[model samples]
Target: MSSHVAPDDQATSGLDRRGELREFLRSRRARLRPEDVGLPSYGRRRVPGLRREELAQLAGVSYAYYARLEQGYGETMSAEVLDAVARALRLSEEEREHLVRLAQPERQGTPQAAPPPQRLRPSVQHLLDGLGVPAYVVSRRLDILGWNRLAATVFGDWAQLTPEERNTARLIFLSPEARDRFADPERTALTAAGALRMNAGKSPEDSYLSSLIEELSQKSEEFRRLWARHEVSCGTVGDIVRMRHPLVGEFDLVHESMALRGGAPMRLVTYHAEPGSRSEEALRMLASWELEPRR
Candidate 1:
């Protein structure tokens, strides 16, 4: 049986894209000051953001067109115009890509229903087993599909949870144990939101993902607040992450997220502690625990 998207859902999605575009443009504009953009701070401006006219002038586009762009009607804006605007705004690569995705969402096309799960390859499992560090495979939706023993030892034994509960975002927002594992829950939660936003853009018609977001939003006011910000991050924010491990106390570890080759939508994330550090010692203990035979 073929799955299909309802027309009402499509309408709602259109509204969402437009609203997201409006907010993202407004937020980006608000951060830039006139002097920063080399524009004269002629008079005391009451509004916090760059004026539409100023942006239009910067991008070498007409005021009417730029105004429409800011109003979330940039669906027809040319690529060159968008590039100019992105340069004027000094947007990062990721931010620029996100702007394009929101403005020209139709060009990318949305799926009719949720995508099927991408299973981990046996090679990937072997690779994880050979690694010394903690590593796990996760889908774009943050589902912890598969994990090695070391990852299990450091992060909770996720094998205990159902497939739905195994999701990283769900755990971060809904599970007390997961929240407690983070050194700073608020920061991690925000990171989760950004990650989800990025993934959602690539697969907008994912009903399972949509349900996950609704559930999280309903369950967590914090999730709702962060999601409303509409920030999309292409990857992890930093090289290092601070995790509070219940077993070995606190850890400041570096992480690497590698996209699995061979057209898989999953990523393999590995956490490494600096050599000879307390965190490294903790990892050694974790490895030892992994080696212990289960009853």
Candidate 2:
């Protein structure tokens, strides 16, 4: 028997989500100080961050062309240019992959019927349970799929919120409480924006993502300014996060992510510390607190 495929399959399967790439590049460029990259500060500039002309010069592109690219022009951007831009922005390897994915999303063999629900597999869930560490799975869209009890405790009230409200990016920019929760609110806010920039490139047509950007832009002037800068960062693995929990007080945690197979909507995230460290002691206290029954 012969099988027939839908005519629109190719378009759907091979869709390119370059809008995110533009956003990511812009965001990264916005955060850098002129002196950070060995350029002398000429004089008092109106913008606190790097100017577009300075970024273009560093990335070896014309200011007008760079503006067009960040504005989602989707012109033919060469790999060489992409490389230069990544270098100028000091993008990590993972961040570079995120850039490539946004610039050229891989055409899947089959089109997905719907966006994958954020979920963790049984095996991964079991692994999380066994590790007894603060762990969770986050989707490419920054959805918190599944998290351990310790994760719930460590993240405080934020973790207890409904999945719709638990989004890190939304909470960081849209919720004032989140800003208070983090010790370094400004860094947290910028990092969340950068991650969102990376995601924008991969799923440009996603309404939820667009809605998030709109909400943040309206609610937070700082978010609006950072969003316009269009920086991107792949926060997938090995990032240090310092948080001030209402219960645990304050602790430093290492955030690590491992990819799952079979297009799983989840990536494994675990928080741990060096052996016999103060963080380990904090983890023990956290675990004890989690075991106690809630009032």
Candidate 3:
């Protein structure tokens, strides 16, 4: 579980963090079956795992009240109620802390002021160069901070855009050109939007994030629908991206993201083809094209 803060009611404010927390907790609980958490699999259960009534019983709350809480209609729950819910769900220490953080926003101070603008370190740049693949570093806000030659070749149009326009989520949702570039545009868009949703919960006050969400909501109906789904995914490792590059046609590549140790606002992303596949040939071609000196 990631950290989350309470949301302010102001329009200028970002996501309602408490709302996010309630939704997250509810979603997590809804997925568990009784057998999943060592509960007895007694008679024909109307629903899998613990029903709302059973959960309410365990937490010492009325079913109506627990339903209200899950619906985000009940605020001001006592710490005792939260603890009971935590125990019922078998929450770990970290998850319990996260729940408390969400329930009691006043306890945590305002998020730290946005960090200063920083560039990738020379050593990190060199490390990317050595990888000799389509690689780049991005901020939590999906800003492209730096990239090697192969990345420039693969995401050239995106890389050439201004800082305000370089966001991956924005490209997936707002740009028709970007939408057409992916083999399965809908899946690609949903995945990108879901990743952004995850980031929103992690850093609710990010100005860039707020701007990106506003832009997408206004510009793309598809994005708006997907955003409302509240899906969250961290594309940290082993995620596959299917691309229909104008130059390379079609190829499937595995993507991985690694946080740079002690480096603020930078995560390295790299892509590679599965072994003994046509994607390998496509990657080699991409590299050759990248290696050529430009005018």
Candidate 4:
């Protein structure tokens, strides 16, 4: 069957939602084994993971129906049906939401103008400035919309970068300094790519977002590999993030992200170190450098 773009997406941004849906489902299915889902293994399989028919049986749907959906032709699929399929695939919360978005673009209501230029609210800016720790605001697309002085000091002066250069995915994948700054570049890059994938599902018709993904795919082999995994995540639990800063040497900080209310999809991300710790001391010293007179 020939694949087609969703009507809303085509009219707004011409993104290939059908292709995305197919790939996402395939990737999710690929990660599971027959035994993983309480299915008895039979003869040797030609492809990896559960066959389309097996998955259909698990979801209590017809084989042809599931195959059509996999091929990107089930726009009318009910939420109940999708939910059952999600359960059959053992998808995560974020992944299930992503599936619905991809499978039913029309339900997303009126599309925005390919995402207008996101501006940071003054109150949010004030909130970032008031925080002693490194803090910044990021759009759903992972664009660094605004950051505080301490954040600039810790994460490198994003002010020096072009708007496009300030994106988290771009910084992690394409920037050399990012590889050096991150203690685990591979994990960081994967996280960034996964977040990007999540946003892609949310706003598939955003041209700028599509361009960013294409750019990274072309320039970064690592990004290409991670993007193919089709993982979806909005946030991870608080964990110590080690940074190898050129000026501060090295330090660890715990990261937290909160969604900003009454605005476009944006997150307030902050990094803080434990009190009375060596990392805290390093952060204090780093903050003072920003206030020191230029020599």
Per-model C-alpha lDDT, please? 0.75, 0.65, 0.68, 0.79
Runs in model 2 deviating more than 4 A are 1-77, 84-91, 94-119, 157-160, 176-179, 291-295
The per-prediction tally of clashing pairs is: 0, 9, 2, 0
Among these predictions, the greatest TM-score belongs to 4
RMSD of 3: 5.6
Tell me which of candidates 1 and 4 scores higher on lDDT: 4
Candidate with better TM-score, 1 vs 2: 1
Tens digit of lDDT per residue, candidate 3, span 1-295? 0212222212135767667666666655766787776666677865445777767877889988777766664347787887898888777554565565555555555554246447778898788778967888777777776778887667664545777776777777777886676778887787777666666655677765766676677677787676655456654378788877788898988988877777455678899998889998998888888444231
List model 2 lDDT by residue over 29-70, tens digit each. Answer: 767899999887898987666777887899999998777766
Q: Between candidates 1 and 4, which one is better according to TM-score? A: 4
TM-score to native of every candidate shown: 0.86, 0.70, 0.73, 0.88
> Which segments of candidate 4 are over 4 A away from where they belong?
1-14, 247-249, 291-295
Query: Candidate 1 at 40: error in angstroms?
Result: 3.2
RMSD of each: 4.8, 8.4, 5.6, 4.6
Per-residue error (Å), model 4, residue 122? 2.4
Best by lDDT: 4
Model 3 weakest lDDT span, ten residues long: 1-10
